[model samples]
Target: MAKILVVEDNEDINEILKNLLLGEHQVIQAYSGTEATLLFKQEIFDLVLLDIMLPGKDGGQVLQEIRQSSQVPVLMITAIGDKQSVTQYLLNGANDYITKPFDGDEVKARIQVQLRQTMSQELAGSKRQEYGHIELDSQTFTVSGPLGQVSLRKKEYDIFQLLLDHPKQIFTKEKLYEQIWQDVYLPGDNTLNAHLSNLRKKLKEVDDCHEYIETIWGLGIRLKEWQSS
Candidate 1:
């Protein structure tokens, strides 16, 4: 099971998503933009179900904040979605999106897709990294920990594979966004934090020490030499 953060002002939608997703994953809800950003700074989540029309900071602002520091997958939730709105959020840095009155099965499918992608990235390990316990055989596209194995989503595999390819070097969020997401914006958001949380969690499941991912404080995150195989 994975952890999800739901950022929406409407109580009804929050409850709906909670009920729909609670069966397969843990759900955390935030009523407003402020609350959502707070939870993001404090915990790790696999995906974020974010709404655009929110109190205080609003959805756009909240998304902006998240993108600055996180790389966690974000799926924008909306009531009034259009081509322009979709383009705006995508350009701002959202992985996927859905309009309101959506199907529960569709949400589940999307969530599963993201989770599976994450699982894949974990197994792939790092580039040139044939580590113990956690083995990522890129050729076969399989990630096997001591316990089991899984496949990675396209985006997750791309960014994670890049890090594994260069375990020692620190790739700034801007660089990562450009390299992975293909763009950059000012001040940044928690997008990097979101992705890091997922990355760290995967590492822990296979290797509790999780030394492969190290935070350099203000600089960025990278894998430790001793931790890498």
Candidate 2:
């Protein structure tokens, strides 16, 4: 059973969610955004059910903070159903969302979907693969080299994996964003760039002397040719 963190300010709603998920999963409750953040840092939960309207930091702020350090699945709980609001939540990294006065079965279904996806990714590649001196352990979601090792967030890992799997193949920003985010790429969207930048930084930390990813000014991005001293 997965461990889930439930963050909601309304006592009644929080209790209802706990009751619904209790038998199938372990649930932790947080009444305010501040408390949710603190609990999240203290525990490693498989999923988070965060309410967009909260007392302390609000759901948007909490989501931003979580994305900074983790790639754990988060299902937003929002009363707002407008297209713009939902779009913002997804772009900000929520895996999914449940509207207020939600149907119990629908909530359960959405949660299951996210959990299943996470499990699938975890079990995708059991063996380690390498390029140059850098190694990727799919099971552990980590990359290591002679210099050091570091764990990568989901997006960062996916970007690296795609490039490593197809060395020398250039992937344009649009292609990368679509494949990684599973959404249409939008102009001026910095999501892919930010993740790529973070991935490059981690690779540099692992092996500083040789670059692993190369950016072709007008073409795209590809794995750098492995060079040996």
Deviating ranges (above 4 Å) for candidate 2: 125-229
TM-score for each of the candidates: 0.57, 0.58
lDDT per residue for candidate 2 within 1-229, as digits (tens), equals 9999999999999999999999999999999999999998788899999999999899999999999777899999988869799889999999999999999999999999999999988787476998888899888789999888999987798889999889979999999888777778999998888888899999999998889899999999999999886
Q: Whole-model lDDT for model 2 versus the true structure?
A: 0.92
Clashing pairs in 2: none
Q: Write the per-residue lDDT of candidate 1 for residues 62-139, one digit (tens) a residue.
A: 888888667788999988747897888989988888888899999889878877887787667644346645776565
Give lDDT per model, in order. Answer: 0.77, 0.92
Question: CA shift at 35, candidate 1, in angstroms?
Answer: 0.5
